[model samples]
Target: MKIQEIREIIKLVDGSSIDEFSYEYEGVKVKMKKNGLGNAQQPSQTAIQEPQFANAEEMPTTKPAKETELIKPVIEEQTADLPGADSDYHKILSPMVGTFYESPSPDEAAYVQVGTKVTADQIVSIVEAMKLFNEIEAEVDGEIAEILVKDGQLVEYGQPLFLVKAN
Candidate 1:
């Protein structure tokens, strides 16, 4: 847990023929090893005190020379906590690398959107791989949760295009 303790552990391993050693204290994991050549500088043990055994000791656990700061970042809410958690809305992902087209042409309205109900085998969108336009179909009847990709974007193999909430 502390740098000095870790150094001491390494030193103990280096001084002896112990190839490796590992143990945990109060949920903190520690491990040390000696290389194949056994060339390791062992730390001298002048005085040692186990954390559990020394409750009244006044020594600072971490080094005071190094300034430590804890930081917390703001996070935006995502739908990961929804009922499905790990599962996305039943999606119809891209089968191949291609350009994704929401509509048949530039003039036509997009096929699906958020809350749009889709039937199994419905033509949801098109992916043009190598100049050949391939129809993307929904494999399950569901409502669109989100359109993950934008129109005319280059999609890779197995890339998610739409998120579906099964009906």
Candidate 2:
């Protein structure tokens, strides 16, 4: 669907009593929900649009934005400390949706732990997706301030996985 059509749907949904709306065209999907004062309450509508894939034959053969941007730096003005960590830490976010593992194998030691010094190219964790194990690296020079996810945890794209304090 066109951007104009999507905007129109959002307007219509916002003015009506409907609290939620979802539409799919070909391969594109759109979801909208109303957020209220709290988790249980419903308020103004929110819209989320999926990729614009009209058909299987026209599907893009490139990696999604989330998958290719591993090592992207997340700058936070004020990040809370974890135990013995410093507050001025850069967050390392996941590049794709997958299962997080701390080690190459269960019997081996973790790639890195809290307080472990790390360089830009050091592998910190492995994220498994579609039967492929992807090694996630520390994109900056720092100490492994904190590990945000546990082993085998299901993590989403862009989710924070580690907090690193620059050396």
Candidate 3:
């Protein structure tokens, strides 16, 4: 349909708990999906699937002779020493895309640091999206092994924030 309508759909999908959404109008179609937590997915702004225009008038009459390949190269992994790699650890992934903060306030100490013991419901950090500040909790009981993200850094959904070693 219209670009504004598509934008509104994207905003609705992003804010809701739904992971995927699709809409169709006449000959046009659109599909969208979110990068859920712990998936290590990159954010995409482009439309996932394109519609096949039914009528000849709706489709472009002249087609290009050359076909374009959209192949992405595989990135090689670097061998760097990671903390808590030897022990049983749980990764705290970002629940949503936002600015991560270690402390509740600018002047206050961080909620939890390396080696700090944390309970399941304990607040470990804050992730701010728009004007709302969301408190992130430690979903598992453990000792903080490493902080993956720096304070005030922009974090993506499913990106690792902290590594916690089980008690």
Best prediction by lDDT = 2
lDDT of 3 by residue, 74-101 (tens): 0111113456656598878788767899
Q: Which parts of model 2 have CA positions greater than 4 angstroms off?
A: 1-87
User: Weakest 10 consecutive residues, lDDT, candidate 2?
Assistant: 66-75
| Local distance difference test, each candidate | 0.63, 0.72, 0.70
> What TM-score goes with each of the models?
0.49, 0.51, 0.53
lDDT of 2 by residue, 1-167 (tens): 44434545665776888888888877777777766646546644454545566676655453232211322322231234444444577778889767899999999999999999999999999998767899999999998888988998766667779999987
User: Candidates ranked by lDDT, best first?
Assistant: 2, 3, 1
Total backbone collisions, model 3: 1
* Superposed Cα deviation of residue 39, candidate 3 (Å): 32
The per-candidate count of clashes, in order, stands at 2, 2, 1
**Could you say which candidate leads in TM-score?**
3
Model 1, residue 72: what's the lDDT?
12
